[model samples]
Target: MTPIRHNGSGSGSDNDHVLDAVRDCVLAVGVRRTTLADVARRAGVSRMTLYRRWPDLRSLVGDLMTREWIDVATRAMAEPAPGTATRTRIVDGLVAGVGAFRAHPLFRKIVDVDPELLLPYVLDRRGASQEALLALLADALREGHADGSVRPGHTERQARVLLLTVQSFALSLRTMTDEDDPELDSAALLGELRTLLERTLTP
Candidate 1:
């Protein structure tokens, strides 16, 4: 997904304020509760200005999720790492993505009340995040296969399976016991994930 270059009116400060307000509102009230009027009031921007820029709540939320949150995940995936260690990168990326999602209250609320909200995004029809993440993993897997460092076959299908695994792990977090440590669970899950990938990619 192309990073959104927010070329808002006036100055960078105003743009930053708007973004901050949107994020704050979403985190506080969730995606369903947040309104353009509320955002305009919170940001101290006129309703006309907010409307002119975002047009609708869905557009604003989509832009915020795509431009801000997903970009962070994409950059994390793009960082210089042991690309040859296919299992390590993919598991680490998935674990980190789950951690990031948990930290976002908006996501937590949606996933808690109605996970269906994520289907459109996860199914890759609503936004670019899913497609970008899938492509990233698929490309990484393909590269590993090409170099003979990782076994090859059904790279795209494997990527999708890994994606589903990550989602399942995240959704299962809520059912964990109080004794469970999220970090430890994440590490264990990722390790198992690496083992699975190893089996798949290592003939």
Candidate 2:
């Protein structure tokens, strides 16, 4: 279920421009309406340049998601705070990953504009972003398990479950009925999510 990331060109600038174009186009007119020509126009690049990087819109979007999520996971792991317990680190990392998905503008745009576009990545195959996230989780879960701070299940399986939970809430919150929505404050949301994660890792 691992999805490959489509590396842009030799220059980081091309990737940035192309990804920026895709994000701008999606925000402006949704994924379905976004085209290579439009992306090129927005990026001030020729269609040839865009094609050289991505065969189509789907490929571009996949890589864009990967880059963004990699940034999210990288940032989360960078600061572990002194003396953080392994299980606590797992919870914190999960919450941080969820926050990234929640706070990302492009993610929000996709959720609001074309939610269906997110289904494949969620239900079927694990794309580059999913793999990146899972790897990060796996590393943390292994550390937790080794220290006897986490549950006894396979680290990869536990990571997958945590990832699914995070993705579900991050992507499907809009589907909640008005009365069903918790409407909790930020602290409450993460606190509840952390509790749920903690129970699975504890006796």
Candidate 3:
């Protein structure tokens, strides 16, 4: 991610403060209703200060989503059980990431309030966050190959397919969920996802 700038200097904490303000604004009124002025006010910074970093609300919100999503993915990838095989680690991390993203407030707001914002990333092109995630998945797959756990293949290709499968689960699982039917509920479907990944990656 590009470093966020403020007052002729760049700082991570400063960037987070700005994104936090953006998050609050979007959560309250959503993307269409949110304004740079409101974000500036909430961030306790001048509007020009925000403009220097982000020309418009869309770019700012894009960066905020990148940060939030990457954080979720990072946390998910970090928590596999001790001594887990590389393929198991990758599958577990991805499954956990699907759940985390589904539960994230910012993701929920965007899906509920401005779902079209996601259409470009889904149909047209990969966004920064998606690229980051692909890189992470590819690296883990390389490790799986080294350990003889994942099937042998082009790492990037394998990672892309893995991401495609996980994205379906993350984005569309809710539509398939049956709350009243334990046999086809979210948790049960996720178990199926776990099994699918295990089979896909096994050497």
The TM-score that candidate 2 achieves is: 0.84
Better of 2 and 3 by TM-score: 3
Writing each residue's lDDT as its tens digit, candidate 1 over 83-172 gives 436555655566677667666666676666546656664455525555666777788778677667566679888787876776665556
Off by over 4 Å in 3: 1-9, 79-82
Report the number of the highest-lDDT candidate: 3
Put down candidate 3 lDDT per residue, 1-203, tens digits, no spaces. 22232233448899899999999999998999999999999999999898887777888898898899999999999644557888988988999999999999999998899998888877878888888999999999988999898999999999999989998888899999998999999999999999999999998
lDDT of 2 by residue, 1-203 (tens): 12576665648876887888888888888888889899989999899888887878888887777777788767766455567768887777777877776788877887778777778776777777788788888988887777788887887888889988877767654454243445655545666788898898884
- The local lDDT score (0 to 100) that residue 92 gets in candidate 1 is 57
RMSD of each: 4.6, 2.8, 2.8
Cα deviation in Å at residue 96, candidate 1?
Answer: 2.8
Error of 1 at 125 (Å): 4.8
* TM-scores, each model vs. reference: 0.70, 0.84, 0.93
Ranking by lDDT: 3, 2, 1
Clash pairs of candidate 2?
A: none
Note the residue pairs that clash in candidate 3: none
**Which ranges in model 2 have alpha carbons more than 4 Å from their true place?**
1-3, 177-189
Runs of candidate 1 with Cα error greater than 4 angstroms are 1-17, 81-87, 112-116, 122-126, 176-187
lDDT of each candidate versus the true structure: 0.65, 0.77, 0.88
Q: Largest TM-score belongs to which candidate?
A: 3
